[model samples]
Target: MTGGRLRPGTIFGIGLNYADTIREMGRETPTTPYLFPKLTSSVIGDGEAIVIDTEITSRVDWESELAVVIGETARDVPAAEALGIVRGYTVAQDVSARDLQEADGQWVRGKGLDTFCPLGPEVVPAADVPDPQQLAVRTWLNGERVQEGTTKDMVFTVAELIAYLSSFFTLRPGDVILTGTPSGCGDFRTPRMALKPGDVLVSEVEGIGRLTNPVVAKT
Candidate 1:
């Protein structure tokens, strides 16, 4: 059932979807979901190495999130029926280059680096995930438990996201939507956690499986 790996399609990502994360950063709740794109070239499957070019970015960080996979062609989907087009759920790490993200003011370059979007170990069918909003998500950096939260904290629900996104354009099968990460991302940590060579990052969602990746120095 792990056939959840994203295929030929655009993967959309959302920012500030988690309410606690917004509050933790002292930001206002978003009236609509803030969106971004993790270019398809940035995708890596489970166990793939997340290569980082230290020269280009000294602040590569982890943002574990839940990813929803599209099962059918959809357009102008309604929130009440959004989940109908979903194929399954998976895990993804929104690996970010914080310096570039904050300095550039736009997220494309900061979030679209090759291997920046670490995708699934497997996709769990939507039928199996009765309530995506109720799932628990966690992130582990190396052996340390760095983040733990539940989807219940999301400011925008998954169904709402689907409906909102499809309203703009058609969402095809295999397209993915990264819901958002929790408040424990590396950039917000006390000492500021960052990804470096030899670090293993594990992202997990309750219904979906975990994605485990190792950090490597970009040659």
Candidate 2:
């Protein structure tokens, strides 16, 4: 709720939703969307500091994702009507502790850390974005563009994702679905790129505003 609105309900995340990103990480394309939950405590607004636990981990990576905010409850909704339930869209940086993520065999511990999820400069109303599927998304670290892609590359469209998700669980108002990031993540690089104490990560979605934040070591 960075745009002067109250907070939402549960926030859902769809992992590995980008095909190129999956291939870059040397993983096979998922037959269905991979889902995860981000605790509300983990969410922080743009320009906030993303605290890194230097003692436990030395490698942290940035993932830029498009977040969908739900406006109504939906269960077993059809893809055709999925967009109708959306309230707005925002940018989210899925900051990850790679070591913890790999060691745990699941994303919860690695992704659920405090300040791991940085969301928004503001939420753009859904009415403003005619096609969420065609927007461009990019990520920059210290002013250097690292990730660039379009939602058209998404393995599953936002509407399709909503339909697929609603088939299992009920989606309520304020619930958010973080669409996955594209290729060029630090962990997928040849030498592996990790966030440093002074690094700045910026994520931007076309039409949606940009979100910038500094990386700091945990006390």
Candidate 3:
């Protein structure tokens, strides 16, 4: 894909949409989707580097997610018709800084850091993915499987998210919605796992190819 295709106009992140994730955080399943906006500048393609500034945070975490790429302008769309506006699907890594996320009491900065949102490998047309909910989402740290889950567990389906989001704001072509991640994020592990320089993070969504990026310290 070209840089233009990789650079989306807006990036929307859904939080705690998986049952295991909700249980890990000890929070009730949300009735409505939890949303946050990520800076487009943070996005990178496969094989790119996920740079981390040691001074800013040492608790960086990884979230494997399936991203919905918008194909047309959407407004007040119904869930049944939401997929009509989807261009395709891609893999994404929601690299996060847990310290900042908690200290700041918000997710923007923690989730929007430069090189935090890694997407691509390639976009699989929406039609190609017969049921977004049937796919598997996974993550690997330096070749060892760190996270494993399925889209079938998402609290809100892709169609539901698109419909809900468009109801409040217009979703233009190239906009991306990171359809919340599954369980096994580093933060809630028995011993927390954080990204470190030299570590390779492999994020995958079934059907969409794997998006691999190396973690590096900011020089």
Candidate 4:
């Protein structure tokens, strides 16, 4: 199903969940953690093209992430029981407008742009993924592998993140929590390599399948 078909719910994301990514960004790892929400409008289906708005943003970067979909409502759930509520997992590309993301001092506008959140070829049932923490997640631009890592590198496990989030608000079915991205984002490159029209991005989670999409100019 397309993101538009999703019911109204919070789209949460964790930032800097990978240690290598934190070091590469030249920032100290967070003591408490960082999280953000994406507008539902930002969600797009796999194989769909992301429209690059060159006039407003020229530095667009791609982030591959594993997304957790909540199956049941959870409030103040304990970490040990957090995974029980996970419905499934899916692949997501957190497309970013670097110039706007850094200049705005906040992620809302830069992250909320339409089609900025590309999710799913299909959601793999949680049962299918026996251990989310043991899976490998990677991203490819065109045919070149740009990012490669495993969930084993995550500083915070999915269960821990769910428990932490539940302490703040209730998580209901259809709610999506983007775990985070690894090192090798386009923005972190020496000269910086941004996505251009025609570039294809594919993110894959070991058992969750791959999400593929091409970049297109917004006309």
Candidate 3 ranges beyond 4 A from true positions: none
Query: Relative to the true structure, how large is the alpha-carbon lDDT of every model?
Result: 0.90, 0.89, 0.92, 0.88
What is the TM-score of each predicted model, taking all chains together? Answer: 0.96, 0.96, 0.98, 0.96
Clashes per candidate, residues 3 or more apart or on different chains: 0, 0, 0, 0
lDDT of 3 by residue, 49-139 (tens): 9999999999999999999999999799999999989999999899999999999999999999999999998889998989999999999
The pairs that clash in candidate 4 are: none
Q: Which predicted model would earn the best lDDT?
A: 3
Best model number under TM-score? 3
What tens-digit string does per-residue lDDT give for candidate 4 at 30-95? 876589888888888877889998898999998888999999987999999999999988888888
Error of 3 at 127 (Å): 1.2
Q: Counting only residues 3 or more apart in sequence or on different chains, how many pairs clash (N, Cα, C under 3 Å) in candidate 4?
A: 0
Model 1 lDDT tens row, 1-219: 235445538889899999878976788888999999889999888888999998899999899999999999999999999999999888989999999999999899999999999888888899999999998999998888888999999999999999999999799988999999888888887888789999999999987888999999988
**RMSD each, Å:** 1.6, 1.4, 1.0, 1.5
Kindly report which residue pairs in candidate 1 clash with one another.
none
Better of 1 and 3 by TM-score: 3
As for candidate 3, its clashing pairs are: none
